[model samples]
Every structure is written in structure tokens, then in C-alpha cells.
Target: MHFVTGGAFNGKSAWVKAYYHMEAEAVGNWFSGYRGDALPEDLHSAAGVIVVLEGIEQWVKELLMEHDPKSAQDMWHAALEKWLQWERGQQGRVVCLIGSDITKGIVPASEEERELRDTAGRVFQDTAAVCERVDLIWYGIGQQLK
Candidate 1:
């Protein structure tokens, strides 16, 4: 797995695209939460060698809406494991998870919002811990962290 993170309006998506060699044809393989795409339950039948899950923060928010914090965390780990399995099943397959850095903002006043914010950090950590490569995008530049 590969993880990419940065603040909103950063070049995360573009950097990821070029780094992964994702051309225009790669659009079909991209599942974006920004467009209301659901969290992937399975990718065994996915066609692309690189699977891109963009706007992961939105997906995390959706997950938190249905489950408690702990359960949501577990659910994310489970999904990551599933994606790992899928990636390992093929020689060239890769899973790319892109998330916005939500931890830099002020703590939200609403308990629910706060959970989402905190969980975003946890989610990024969870991904970073297992990812083969981690990167941060800033102002259209990508710096590798792993």
C-alpha cells in the first residue's frame, strides 16, 4: 500500500497520479469519496493494477457516521487488510490511499466533529504504519516520508 497526505488544495492527487503513472485512462479505477463513492468492500475484481482511493477523509467520516470510534477504527483496519490481500494476490497490484491532513485544524466544538478529526489522524497513522511508501504533498511538491 501507498499513503499520501496533505492539507486541502495541496497537490496530493496530482503527485500521486504522476508517481503512480496514472494517466487519463486510470480514471475508471479511481474510487473517490468526494464524488460520493462508497468505501470499497472488495477489490478482487477491480481491473486496474493500481487502485486509488481518493478523498479518504470523506470515507472515514461516512464510516464514523455508522459506527462508534473503536468499531470504525477496526473497520478501517479490516478494509486495509482486505486491500493488502488483494494487492498481494497479484504481482503488480497496488493500493493507494490518499487523505487530507485534518489534524492541523483547531479542535472542533462538536463531539461528533471532534471524533472525526481525531480519527483522521488515527487513520493516517494506521495507513502509514503499514504502507510501503508514505508521502506528503505541499504546494504541488511531493516529499517522500517512507
Candidate 2:
């Protein structure tokens, strides 16, 4: 698995498209890309494909509204576990998770917003630990983090 992260408009997706030499679309069951406000219900369906998940911060924000703090955290953990397991089960398949680096900015005033920020940070850290490559994009330049 690969983790690609950066602030908004940092060109992470552009870099990924160029590096992979393909657009974000389903191609012969080998690749799929998704950008949505919420996590897909059937994550395992993407098994055996190079899956790219964008706008993860948005998904976290959505989660914050629908559940309590602990519940939201549990949902995040469950989703991550599913993705990790799917990646492990598929040889030669890559999972590229893309999330904005929201923790660099000012701390949020609302408790829910603050929790969202913290959750995103913790998720990124944990995911990066297991990923084969971690890239941080800044002003369109990608720096390898791990």
C-alpha cells in the first residue's frame, strides 16, 4: 500500500496520475479510484485493483456528524482494518490512500472539529507505518516520508 498526503491543491492527484500513467477510472479490474464524502460500504469489492481513495478528510468530517466520538473512532478503525486486510490478501495490488494534511493549520474551536483533526492525524500515522511508501506533497512537489 502507498500513502499520498498533502495540503489542499498540492497536486497529489496529478502526481499520482502521471506516476501511474493512467487516469482515475476502472480499467480491466486492475485499477479503481474513488473520491466521496463517505467511505464506501463495500471496500473489499476493490480487491486485486490499484485503489485510490481521495478526499479522506471529507469522509472523516461526515463521520463526525453522524456518530459520537468513540463511535466515530471505531468506524474509522473498522474501515482501516478492512482496507489493510484487503491489501494483504491481494498480491501485486496497490492501495493508494490520499488525505489532506489538515493538522498543519490552526486548531479547531469546536470539540467535534478538533476530534476530526485528531482522528485524521492518528489515522495517517497508523496507515503510514504499514504502507510501503509514504509521500507528502508540498506545492506540487512530493517528498517521500517513508
Q: Which candidate's TM-score is highest?
A: 1
lDDT of 2 at 24: 58
What tens-digit string does per-residue lDDT give for candidate 2 at 60-98? 777777886567767867776777787777676677888
The Cα RMSD in angstroms, rounded to one decimal, for candidate 2 relative to the true structure is 3.0
Give the range where candidate 2 is weakest over 10 consecutive residues by summed lDDT: 28-37
Model 1 RMSD to the real structure?
1.1
Q: Pairs clashing in candidate 2?
A: none
lDDT of each: 0.88, 0.74
Per residue, candidate 1 scores C-alpha lDDT tens digits across 55-114 of 988988999989998888889999999999999998998999999998886888999989
* Candidate 2, superposed: residue stretches over 4 Å from native: 24-37
TM-scores, in order shown? 0.95, 0.82
Q: How many backbone clashes does candidate 1 have?
A: 0
**Regions more than 4 Å wrong, model 1:** none
Any idea what lDDT model 1 has? 0.88
